[model samples]
Target: MSLGAERRHIRDVTAWQPRVPGVVEVFHAHYTEYAYPMHVHDAWTLLVVDDGAVRYDLDRHEHGTPHGTVTLLPPHVPHNGEPVTEAGFRKRVLYLEPGALDTSLIGAAVDEPDLRDPLLRRRVGQLHTALAHPGDELEAESRLVLVRERLRHHLRPRPVRQPHPDERPLARRLRELLDERTAQGVTLGEAAALVHAHPAHLVRAFSTAFGIAPHQYLMSRRVEHARRLLLAGQPPGEVAALSGFYDQAHLTRHFKRWVGVPPGRYARTSASLT
Candidate 1:
């Protein structure tokens, strides 16, 4: 939703628990005039404001979330928030499990909860987008690990080195796994365990080797399978299930993305020529 024009003061909130591990919940909100009373949560609150801003008191200290800022409220901290301007605020949030970040860093997070990292802000937004999709668990999990690592870096600075280690074998093994399970996709965690590599590393290896991410590779496989099924005169609804899509809508989305036409249109158009 765009914040280009002023929107009415109606509380809008979306919350869900994704299948990805370590993330307890995803919460998104847009409020014009509402104010939050002092409360505490059992999970760590990671927030980013997309429009307007938020002014909050965390642990008796005042903090504000301006645009381009990533906010972290440690678990068990008492906080209260309200809009920073008349325009109110639109924000995306992630509630991570307590263990996602070590307890030792809680003090650092409480000391300085707001981070002004542009890359981190962008990655968090992408992570939210990935989490919104139902069948993109692997992409969500991959982004989550990177976001978590970046959060840790802010709490405790570390040197990041880019390595070019050979990972072709690992990448090939992952391709084989994807090919075998195209009808029923595998989770990043499962692929990592089966391939004996770290989840993030596995994703990196696959992308580096194949020029596409693992989830994208699987989706392309499914889309191609759907194409073949459609050419065989199979109905779009049945092709969706047979090709490992969540439903017909999901099939149409990926199919159109790859083929430049929806399943029904493609089937009918090709048949008309024959």
Candidate 2:
């Protein structure tokens, strides 16, 4: 098929992924001839250009992203985008909710939308890749930290962190509760009540101590539970329901997303390898 025909077979992935807190949407697209209308997003729009280039007008100023460039479009900024090359462009875009980046860090990006740091660019790309797979929660979070640190280093230095009181005990307790109620699932409020803290406070504390959100930690654990059950020869349907997922399809969705393959494929592969 011609490149144009091949492009036709592909569809733009404008998925509203809530994989992480403070993130609203994740977009991945390859376009040969596409243009966006002048619009604004309520969340920060971060773009990672993989191949080719994109031209856009951000806040009334024109900008061009060359191949391998990464750009940050702050929230509420009006912008429109179109391809700058014949091959068009392939990009991963993130729509992050407010508070993902501190107010202080945003100004630098406003003055310079396209960043030149290779490390920052690389981590952004890695973040996207990790988010697409299963069991990559830690990697994704780690990349987020590095990306933030890199941005801070370039824009303005943050005060060095000192030793702080440990909150691991609370984090551990929350994890235990989640494990005990895996199938039934504990609401954040229930977890907070069990821990004798406000739900919002509990979320912040748990994430601070563990480096991953409570919901994410529970999700990873459930996926782990399903893996064990699957390895023991349980069918996907049972694994799904038993592992806190509503049904087989629900389980398959999170399973493949976190584990890199569907449960059946994972089981069959493991059997062959063994």
Candidate 3:
């Protein structure tokens, strides 16, 4: 049986609220003649299309979402979704907390950057099945662990260097420093010193090349590191220390703002799956 199509268009915060705790709210949305304007959320939004095509713009990047494909949005990033066909778009969205991913067996698996893995796809399918049937929390959680493991393994590959002809030597060094010190923390002054440039010049040049301020880019890297640690079952306090946040509360505030959930919840849900 198919979940009935919901045609409402959500354009404001009042139209959205947090779904049930621990459970990923699944919805089959049909945009026959409507679209969702730019908005942001506080949870992981996983969109899996089953029919038609959906065009989404996230952080200035445009994507054409097709059937059998998934799109993941980390919280608070502005995005807009629209149908590419007159037939409109039909898709399932799964809203999950970080804690819903914790499983000792799959702990490492969920830590990967990329979430698109065959195993993860299967697990997402299982989650859809579980949502279709109520009162099967145990089975749902079990499948969640399997999906987490596959995602972790698939994401554990080493970073690949993409060719960049426009990258200057100093800019490249700055990028490297950001990556290396993301978990360790680096101040603007410190980064500027590394490249022998003044802080103001560095800031302007970095922003020109990356389209975001240097400090913002640094914060994003730190958050990315924190996310991996949290997914790997690390405590918020520890992740804060490692990721250069001043304290657990600081990390919590930013993590929630960006990821749409606190570290504790992410850790707990991940742990429950094991």
Candidate 4:
């Protein structure tokens, strides 16, 4: 199936049951007029907004999410959400148990250490696939292996960084743009324009100063906003759009690839905890 069709199938199946024990349930829901209040979950809650904008409060911080965004909530973090307008909202939720990851695999060993890192999109994809198709021990083992390899690769040490006082002006401008437009999605060229430099020059400077490219930094900011919305109870489709993704499917593709589960499943599992 195409990625879009596959995601729809996954979303449909996820809404059926709570899925595996200790593995948590994945599901989707729409809030026409109702909304979820502040609540906490015993399991990790990951999600994406699929439709309208959802407003959320996480640890006293508030966020407004549109569509095509992914959200991640660590276990037990107090959060709540509601629709921003009368249109209501739609979203996906996934619940994940502590230690549910297969530590026997090398990638699984490092999963926890970097769970909060925004760059783990691929790891999330593997976990989602494993949960989507639960079966024999051998298949599970293979999934674990894939997770291990990915984690191992991620955990490898990289060269240390040195502070650059010279890049402060550019860096500050980049950060401001990220903070203001994270939901809108900022491109490298656009970011560079603010600093009166070429995209390539800005990218090189950003890498040397922050150890990552400009676009990666922007994605991290977007993901952070998405997380805040999920905790507040925004739907996946809305979150995706707000986070600069093209659509629900686009957001799901990246969210599952990064966070290990679809957005709707994350929200449903989170709601169930309350």
Across residues 1-274, which tens digit of lDDT does each residue of candidate 2 receive?
A: 8986876545343333435655565556677666764544446778888888989886457999976667887653456688887677878877676677776655566667887888888888888887666567688777777776776666652332211366667766886787688678988877888898888878887766544566766666677677667766678888898899988898998775554457887666434422
lDDT of 4 by residue, 119-173 (tens): 4444455455555553633554465455435444544443323338787567657
**Global lDDT of each candidate:** 0.79, 0.69, 0.59, 0.56
Least well predicted 10-residue stretch by lDDT in candidate 2: 156-165
Candidate 4 accuracy as TM-score: 0.42
For candidate 2, the per-residue lDDT at 150 reads 72
lDDT preference between candidates 1 and 3, better one: 1
Model 4, position 10: C-alpha lDDT score:
37
- Model 1: per-residue Cα lDDT at residue 44: 88
Prediction 3 global C-alpha lDDT: 0.59
TM-score of each: 0.55, 0.53, 0.49, 0.42
Across 71-100, the per-residue lDDT of candidate 1 in tens digits comes to 998875556688888778889888888898
Off by over 4 Å in 2: 1-10, 14-18, 156-274
Among these predictions, the greatest lDDT belongs to 1
What candidate 4 gets wrong by more than 4 Å, as runs, is 1-162
For all predictions, the C-alpha RMSD in Å is: 17.4, 12.8, 10.7, 15.9
Compared to the true structure, candidate 3 yields what TM-score? 0.49
Best by TM-score: 1
